[model samples]
Target chain A: MSETPDTLVEPALARTPLDALHRELGARLVPFAGYDMPVQYPTGILKEHLHTRSQAGLFDVSHMGQLRLCGRAADAAAAAAALETLVPGDLLGLAPGRMRYTLLLNDGGGILDDLMVTNAGDHLFVVVNAACKHADLAHLQERLGDRVAIEVLADRALLALQGPAAAAVLARFVPAAAAMPFMSYAEARLRGIPVLLTRSGYTGEDGYEISVADDRAETVARLLLAEPEVAPIGLGARDSLRLEAGLCLYGHDIDRTTTPVEAGLSWTLGRRRRSEGGFPGFATIRDHLDHGPTRRRVGLRPDGRAPAREGTGIVDGGGRPLGHVTSGGFGPTVGGPIAMGYVASAGATPDTPVTLVVRGKPLPARVVTLPFVRQNYYRG
Target chain B: MSLIKFTKDHEWIRVEGEVGTVGITNHAQHALGDIVFVELPEIGREVVQGGEAAVVESVKAASEVYAPVDGEVIAVNQALIEEPARVNTDPQGDGWFFRLTIADPAQLEALMDETAYQSHLEDLA
Candidate 1:
């Protein structure tokens, strides 16, 4: 079925620091998360996605929210403990220069947002989805404002240099970046320009997310693009890459209605927090942990070449309703159609047969292990 | 003599006698990005003018290929089932979707000719 175009009148979209640069590179600009962002460049999403997996792809992710969470006394430990009340991760165990992925949950065990929290020595560095940033800020303020100061880093631009060759390409600018272990953070100077570098990315590749001042974002992007191994990637490829990696996209694969356990993100719930039950919806989350969720998100591999898209319904052999696809598209790396959606726990087994209803036709598919493509993180 | 016509929807129909070879214009393919899949109309099925005759899926989304005029599907391009990218590479030539027996030649008058279609594209831009 053809997707309906958004015809609602839009307010003036905000521009990223590299907006002009994206246009100069022949990007097809589109409104995304209230920002005028590049959907794809002249290279197109297919080529851009494959390029990121093989070489390095530079992404302009400045639209996401970045904030500093510090205790009243500027103590990282105190701030981490205060933040722990909001998320299910073990932020107190997050050592200096280390980062952990966690989810902000509502009182009923629903996920508010999934975010990254890094122990930045003096304070906690947090990054949340662009669409949920404002709400997350308000949530943090209303809950922990008195104990922790939430400072929005509005003047910063975030860039991700990701792929198999990302380390080598970044090393030319900051030699030490290549040696940083996965999930490690550092305040480093790239060619004398100070920036925050994190050895992490959304593409499941060895990479770095660099946070730089807005004014220098374009310069830094241009410098990285000058490298033979680096090319500018857009939101189109980013979505496909993350989808193939089995990572969730906010509001699509996950949202306020889904719990971490049902989303197959039980690992994000810290071991200590699992038993202590201090986070919001801890009672419900603990129940889900003790007894598996009624429905669990599983990867779907559609038979044949036709791609099953989001909102496509899934059914069993007898045509009983199972669930609907949350994220589905062509996985260029997997060389076939891949999808992720929730299904009854009885039908969530890998290799179980399921039918995807596409345009009123029952298309054969199977529940498969997530991450159509294997993750290649650099642990060393 | 053979005549080619274009629709405002970016579909093109090349008419020869009672049969018309149909496909999407290059502009439409470029706008849709990479073509990942194509679903052609079933042979011998009747279609109405401006009705959805086929489906072309890009990496990003799926779009309907509307019929330029009334016709009866005669044959489909089976090659696209395995090589949909051909639509992106040669949208108007080898990427022809299907051949149909024209139901009413008068319906073709509403379609834009090459010159008119070029101007129509410019207006859209």
Candidate 2:
């Protein structure tokens, strides 16, 4: 677990794969998920955000957990099917090189963590959120350890090249990466280094997340940054970008107490899994889906300028307590403040008048459709 | 020229006789990533020394700008409402938070001058 830095005695923070490169590039490093991460570069958060939208921004996301589940080539189906017992996503139909965004669930239908599951040719590749990695690995170990091989790739570093021009920048290095569609992954070579390149990202943009050996991380990152269209992005703009895209940040939007249904992630539940009902929390998730969830995660667009931050009380027009703001911030692309939080289902409708109690004052806000900024994923 | 003074909290006051213009120091703005919103105090509002007078919201977090000395708010920066980014660009000038009628001009003696404030920042590091 990462220690919170106090004003006095500072705690030791781990460095990411590209820590030295980040310092050379003028990044303002901050502690995140037990690692010293660049929150923003000298280019600034706003510029990095705008640059990613217009061009491409490369992000070092090595702190996340990368794992592989392996068995015999033909028997890989068994490993994939076994994973279904924990997550509710459809894994049986996952073709080679395909990827799906799914959640790890507890027995009570609460989301343990959200992750990406890919069907590697002979095995399965999984990437989980950093903070929940230890727990997720332990959960899998206690559940399916005897059935399959769970390999932790601690020597791997993950990099996300995101934006409208991300493909163009990456194609210059690996032409094959240009052919992979969204939500697909393949073991490919970039600049002569073997890496797992995936056509997916959290920014709601057409992007590629490259997973390379930790030792070669700097070389890959520098090559990408060398592209005219690519700039080194930091965690600051990453949060803002994902916020505007209506993506959830673990430990904030969704936790062990929040079910996937309540978190607006029911779409990730596979149709077969919903009926087969063998996974953890299957009963509670199905029941909630059958009879609409009592509460829901919805987007909020404040009518005024003041940003209603996390933990701010969300109230109705009459000042009655409705819910609370889970994640809120000013979105540069949306050109206004955007937030997402759980509200009573009745108040979750878009355009519902609500008030965010910011600093004891009732700040006017309204429910808006999620993805405050529209997604630009490459479909073809 | 108005004599400029700074507080330990990183606020600056440009004292021009009985009136003073207040704003956050450049060092403070740099610390607060990007300034996205500014909540100004109401004109004619009474303020106590070192009390909350304004609010500045950055992309990272929100911070309260305090009154360096007891005073009555004579004017608040209206331009900040639409362009709060100005605080990041020119915090000590166009980003000035407010102007107030000094309730106790003698309190100005407690603030640090440019040289003293510069040395204080070094001590902090």
Please report the candidate that would top lDDT against the real structure: 1
Show pairs that collide, candidate 1.
none
Per-residue accuracy of model 2 over A221-337 as CA lDDT, tens digit each? 999988899999999899999999999999999999889999999889899888888899988898899998889999999988999889999999788888999999899998888
In Å, residue B13's CA in model 1 sits off its true spot by: 0.6
TM-score of each: 0.98, 0.97
DockQ of each: 0.56, 0.42
Query: After superposition on all CA atoms, what RMSD does each candidate show versus the true structure?
Result: 1.3, 2.3
- Worst window of 10 by summed lDDT in candidate 2 chain A: A1-10
Off by over 4 Å in 2: A1-10, A72-75
Encode model 1's per-residue lDDT on B4-123: one tens digit a residue. 999988999999999999999999888888889898999999999888999998878878989888989999999999999999899889999999999999999999999999999899
**Model 1: per-residue Cα lDDT over A115-152, one tens digit each:** 99999999999999999999999999999999998999
lDDT of 2: 0.90
Q: lDDT (CA) for every model shown?
A: 0.93, 0.90
The deviation in Å at residue A86 for candidate 1 is 0.7
Best by DockQ: 1
